[model samples]
Target chain A: MRSRALALPMAAVLALSACTGALSDTGSLLGRDTLRIGVKADQPGLGLRGPSGEFTGFDVDVALDIAERLGVEPADVEFVEVTSAEREEALREGRVDMVVATYSITPARKTEVTFAGPYYVAHQDILVRADERSIDDVRDLAGRRLCQGEGSNSATRVIGERGVAARLIEAPTYSECVTMLEEGEVDAVSTDDLILAGFLLRSRDAFRIVNAPFTDEKYGVGVAEGDLSGCEAVNRAITDMYQDGTAEALLRMWFGDTGLDLVTSVPQFEGCS
Target chain B: MTAEAPPRPDRPTARSRAAERARRAAGRTTVRVWTLTAACLVGIAVLFAVTTGAIAQARDGFQVIGHGAGPKVAATADLYFALSDMDAQVANVLLMGDEHDLGAGREEALRRYEQRRDDADSALLHAAQLAEGDDAEQENVRAVLDGLGDYEQLVAEARLLNDEAGGGAGQPPAAVVDRYREATDLMRLELLPKAYNLTLESGATVRATYEDRRSATRLGPVWVALSGAAAAGALIALQLYLSARFRRRYNPALVVATAGVVGLVGLATLMLDDQAQQLRTAKEDGLDSVLALSRARAISTNMNADQSRWLLDPERADTYAQGFLEDAQTVLYVEDAAGEVPGDLAGYGAEVDDAVTERGGYRGRMLGFLGEEVRDAPLAGQAAAQQEVLRAYDGFLRADRDMRLIAESGREREAVSAHMGGAGSVEDAFDRYEEALIELTDLHRDTFDEAVRAGDDGAAGWDVLLPAACLAFAVLVLAGVRPRLAEYR
Candidate 1:
């Protein structure tokens, strides 16, 4: 009788313990049947949620391609929505095995996540209402409310390094910022030309990019900081994607009709090892 | 819970014996009732603490969102942008020789320069006000403000030297170059770094406040609710147990206590639920907008620096050529590459032919981000601005080719002349392109506030309601329990 009573308490303790998962200090990205790849669900061309609840975007395509290269079936790659602010957290928490969002590789970010292959290089540019003609260049930015998204240091470079006297506004996503611009809440939205093109193509609004890109941004795949093998594998996939005519094909497939400079040339890859 | 023992005459009869047993049972039940009462009070106290703590956290989070992340970050972004623009204006002045000699052009550049400088001053003032207390931010702003005065004097001296040199077709005197170089160095290394530091500090502050708001302890609500429910359940069971044991239909005090405890549990749950909802909305919607603006400003600032570098270092001709080419190709998707400049102008003609052949499409821009002779690129004319960019770039590339030819013949002076000369010069072509870029940059600047408005709007309703909800929770518990305590009395 006593043994049974103790067994009940032990089972209760076991039940409570089940609530706490293993305390993993870093991502233990072992081989699994399904790989959870985090991406932006709101960034239209890079990562977007479709009507069918499936994700579609350049990042999604890239992630799919990488999965194929990893010997994992494309159908097995699970997509998770990750925002700019949550990228590091998601990786650290092991909520996703890899991040294929339009992740920019920077030294500061390297502290939290390892990056693989800068598969594409994007330049910083501005988007304005189609009829807006008074603003055309970076120099004309004084006294304007520029909308940019959070969690990355993309906007400060323009204001801090360039010395444009502009007001700064923040948004959670590029799409929402575009909505603000459309609503006349903000005068302009600025980001990578590639991202802006995605917005323009999907927005169905009269928005145009002011053919002036100022900074070079190298887009890389992000993995948890300690996951060296995963980072290396991602880099390999990117290189293969470029070599096998896949990257060019993908760009044309998604961005060919957008009037964006769809140069199919693979971007310079950053160091992997 | 407390009850008096009734006076009983000893008898074996049913009535007297029953009364005596009932009294004994009531005395024991009183002790159990008091224990439950203490347990209920402990649960309520814990609930009070949890809810109140959450309220304080919400208050702090709201304050930081309102005061620190709100206007302060926006002002800092402006301050940083203005300082860089001012530096660019100075570069423009340097690029234009003898501000008084160029008729209408002179006046226009001077007017724009002065206006830009004024904007910088105003932005600095605004940033200082925003950064009033923080030692690091203040220090950085002060350094930039102080450095600007000296930078202006150096620019003036350089302009004077260039004017005295008759803004010659040939390279200006070494002294003039030295003066300009000094000014550029000061802006690049000293003033700009300080401005960037100020921006970094501001960004850090905003992120810190955001993290604090997001990192609020949730331990309070979940635990409090659990304890509260358990306490209420215990109170109800105690009331039922006492009524059955004492042979009474109901103990009014115990009944009231049980109801009061249950009500307190509901109120606590309600309060926490409200807080949780508000916190989620604030983070997802409001703070996100602030972060977006921060990114746009940083990118623009970096691009501005690249533009300045193109003009500041004319000596590194090939480097500038390649940098400009890559920057153009990356954005405009222009398929043009700077062919190898021959050893001593021997291969200049061949290089020109190669460029002309490559200029038609994406075949000219580097492929594989590293490969040469990239091909099969997209066409231009997506937007009017885009067309304008292509035109300016085409004009500049042609001009750059001419400069290359001049540079090759070993006539370094003639090359320098073509490099920085007026009208159709490499410098002039780039100026046009940069003008377009500035216009684009200006358009985005005005959007910084509106981007985050929706998020801010969602968060605005969160701040004032949290404390009131918590207070309501406490009040509801008090009103429900007070009558029960009086029944005990």
Candidate 2:
């Protein structure tokens, strides 16, 4: 009877030992089969959801490619609508696997997650009514009302760093910024050069980008912390795409005569430190 | 012999006495041995539990450091690079946009701006990915991209207007220039910051992650060491008890159990030690070194871009470039004087000085080149200097491109420019600058990788050791327990 009693405890101990081994397995953490990606739903040429609810854009294409590489089919991937303010939080809290949003890589963001690729490049520029010829430089907007997304780096640069004493009007989206400019609610809208090109093309005679840009903004793919393997894989894919002329082809397709140039032949990994 | 023995009334029968003594001794030893074995078994189990806990803690520590803090640092570095690239592109675009010369000079500037624009967009995309929040940030980014598209279209129209007005004549109409200026101003004032904040958002997240990872990883090792000691102690006690009870020097079961506990404890300790060492090295070499070098490179890029812009419109561009240079100098000073240059900056001090001297020489030559032109005559020599600058910039860019290629290809060259001296017809001076930056980036990367490897290696070692120790302690306990069964039998 005593021996039997001891055997029960011994079995319990062995069971517990097995549990420890299972607990130590790191593979479970890596199993992110169905990934949720945060991306822009409005920006044409970069990221926009179609009528069929399929996301497409230069940035979207890159994101999709990355998903495909991760063994997830395009249909299996879920797209989460995201904005500049929400992207970081969504990524940090595990709400999304990656953000393919036309997000700019900056010193402030390196603190949150691992970033891969400078998939696209753009410059911050001003958009104005085509006929209006008064404003010549960022400095001339001292008294003009400038529209840009709130919490955006463009607003910060115009209102804070560049010291353009413009009446800073915050918009919810780039379209809103453009609308404000069109409606004369604001004198101008600030954003990336190629995006401004798309808007101007749509507007035709309505708006134009200023000759000078205020800043350069490089777009990257974001992954959760410690996901270096994922980061590396995505970076390699981007680099391969660049080398294979996939990036150039995509750029040509979206931005016809906007004259956007591809700077690096491969996507470079700028370590977050 | 015993059967033949006669009974003695005083001593009793020999066989009966011997049997009685043996029975009493056996009973006493059996009881004692069983108690000792039970105690040893309990000790071994407790030790194993403690050791296992310690090893688990060590693993957790490794995770926090490797996956958490390490990533945060890497991400932050990326953010800085992105922001710097953005700033540089903006400067370049503005410079290009300001150029009124409709010939080759104007086209070159536009081409350069377009290239820079592409770079900025790519950086922004990466930043967006790193940024956390919800769809709000993504929406904001999309909005900015749209706004920028509008801005570029406007610039293109203005460029066309200027070209028509120029008609290959002496100069374009001031009105056309004004139109171009207006378009350029709108884009710069309205659209640029929307993109820049994306970077700021990314930087903020990077800072938070770094702090969290650092704290979490720091606490893992102590827990592991304590648990390991407990397991080892239990195993030793079990072995002693088994030896004493068995009265035979070697108790196989007890020996196995003791060995198991000792092995487990030893392994756990080793793993913890290695991880701790790795974390320390990463902090000292990788994080710090990479941060400093990246900061310097970012600043330098920003300055160079501003310089390119200033060269386009000497009057206004110069001022902006000067401000950018000051900022760059500040970054350099912080990197150099803050004692963060990763080892002695003394060795590279001479090289840095030489680069600075070369920069000064170039500036002087540029000034003389510009002075020869009539100040009032439509900035004629600007085309020449613009071409020179373009050549130099492209040279630098090509070098940078090659360096990235080399790094990606895993070809570890001490200096980047060593391999690509013949790819382009670039000035040797510009090549040197590009090479220097590449070298700096590579040096820091190497240091960071070494630290990471150390940490990983340490964790791997611990992974092996902790399990071994647990098995050893278990064996020792089993060895100790087996002797008690013999006594019971």
Candidate 3:
């Protein structure tokens, strides 16, 4: 009688496991040899798609390293361009196995899709023209035209929580924002320092970051909800990426020239549900 | 006679009085004939002035629309083509990368780019001259010039950066790509649009002139006929009155004048009819074809540039790919055709070609540059020339498909090699297509020139003949009436 009762619970657990595995976006990715990871195409050093028809930068390297850890070859990894707005939808629709597109881990986002790691803790900073000196801190952005990238909430952080009454000017991408800033159309560009660092690499002396960071934007790898196994797998990969010094090397290679305090350690991972 | 009037003391005799009355009546008849003849002469002169003025105006209308603004607008289309080609060459040079000795070589590409720049500059100067009177056109020209300056600056920056960071074929530095993106964006968004607008503005002028002038010429015959009839009727009335009052069968001079007026009216009507026909031919066949073909050439050139951009910038490969398809459709469109791949072009071209030749199954349905060309193939050899152009364009589309397939199959280097290959390259195919288009344009241009010439020829000698005929008619009328008046004396 006890043996029969034990078998019933085991069968129930097995069925539940099967159901989770089938529904999990990350679980499906684990089974496949080829993995499609969403990334940013326009960012210069973070996840830029280069002229060689290849994706290059810090995020790309991390994605490849994670894929390698997941037993998928680098060649088997396909990078799809994903913007801030489409990250969650891309994961839910199975358009991407996971998005390493500078996605931030937030409580609201965690409700929609599971997040793997904080992989890199980026600070929100302000970018302005090199010659401009009147405004330095985030507070000084008041009444100035601040470029807001489409689908990015960086503009809200300045005006909403910070109470800065800065005027928001929208652009399709951060690259376009930089373009606007270069042409004097926008007074400043506010985003993650890493993204700004990428733009600074190309412009040389045309722009500079204010270094006054406010808000800790913990970049995360997003997976479909209920994909606990997949999320755990990604977490393990993130840990390996840091322990093996691959993360540090990638960060240094892409953002070394840009004057930012490079974080060289594993970030605090958001626990998988 | 003695019973008629028993004379008063003042009257000498009844016969003498009757003779006086008869002489007064004859003198009055001569005066009436002279007055009517003078009035007929004035009416003939009026007809001469109106008919001659209409002919001269028709001739001038043909010159202005057919030769002046019409050709100038077509020349601005060359400017559009040149600007597109300049960007294409820039992309080509960048695609060459560290490999300076490709099929055409970077040096040759740069040289072509410079040549196109010069051509564009000259075209701009010509456009400015054409847009002299209209403030809006002048402003558009100025805007294009400013945008061109910005575009050139960005291109120079891209080239400098690419040269500094020399890499393999089809792999430019990130910074170079960024600069090129800016430059190409500005060219596409600002300069090209403004240049096309210049053409559009000038084309509008030609169209307005054509409508106004053609309408005038169309009604010229009717007005000339009405006035001529009035003049002829007056002459006939004068002749009838003379015959009745003077008891003569005919006045030879007056009869000749009436025949001259009728003949002049008939000739003027025929000339005016011919002028209207010439104007229609010039506008519908000549200028219309030139504009459409110019647009086609420019669009095709830009489409080829999109191919190079696709090969060079892989990040936006799909975007460029989409652009290529859209441009292809613009050049030669087929309904419900989703040209996702290069192979799809052949079917689309075939469908369009079938519609072009059948002219019945799908007549008026096929739409685009090539569609319009086939629809209105009015010239002697124009239909055959349009078919040749379609064939050449099909060849180019095929080559483009092959290149794109190679690129898509992960053989980018081979694709680039094939693209830069001299003989069987996309560029070569496009050049042949351009050749065919030019030939067609030349045929239409000839027609335009010929129509204008015919318009001038039709109105020839009317200016002097009209006044001379009027003078002759007047003298004939006076001569016929002078004898009657001399009878009174």
Please list the C-alpha lDDT of all candidates, in the order they appear.
Answer: 0.59, 0.54, 0.79
Alpha carbon lDDT at A92, candidate 1? 84
TM-score sort, best first? 3, 1, 2
Candidate 2, B320-433: lDDT as tens digits: 433453433334321223332111122223323433345434321111111121112222243343334323433553443443355336442211222222343112444455
Q: How far is candidate 3 from the true structure (C-alpha RMSD, Å)?
A: 27.2
Q: Which DockQ-derived CAPRI band holds candidate 2?
A: incorrect
Tell me how large the interface RMSD of candidate 3 is: 36.3
Please report how far candidate 3 places residue B102 from its true position, in Å.
2.1
| lDDT at position A130, candidate 3 | 89
DockQ metric, candidate 2: 0.02
- Superior candidate under lDDT, 2 versus 3: 3
TM-score of each: 0.46, 0.45, 0.62
RMSD of 1: 20.3
TM-score winner among the candidates?
Answer: 3
Q: For candidate 1, lDDT tens digit of each residue in B1-489?
A: 346554545646888678767766656655665565555555556555655665566556556654455555555555555655555555545544543432224566567667767867876776687677865457656767878888889979977877777663334556776886777667654665455445444554555465445445233345455555555555565556555655567666555655655665565555555554554444433333333333333333433334444444556443333344433332333223552212211132233334434445523432211112112211122234434434554565566667767755766545544655578776687668655544433333323333333334433443454345434444544453444445434
lDDT (10s digit) by residue, model 1, range A16-67: 4443322222353446678999999888888999888899988899889988
Better of 1 and 2 by lDDT: 1
lDDT of 1 at B318: 32
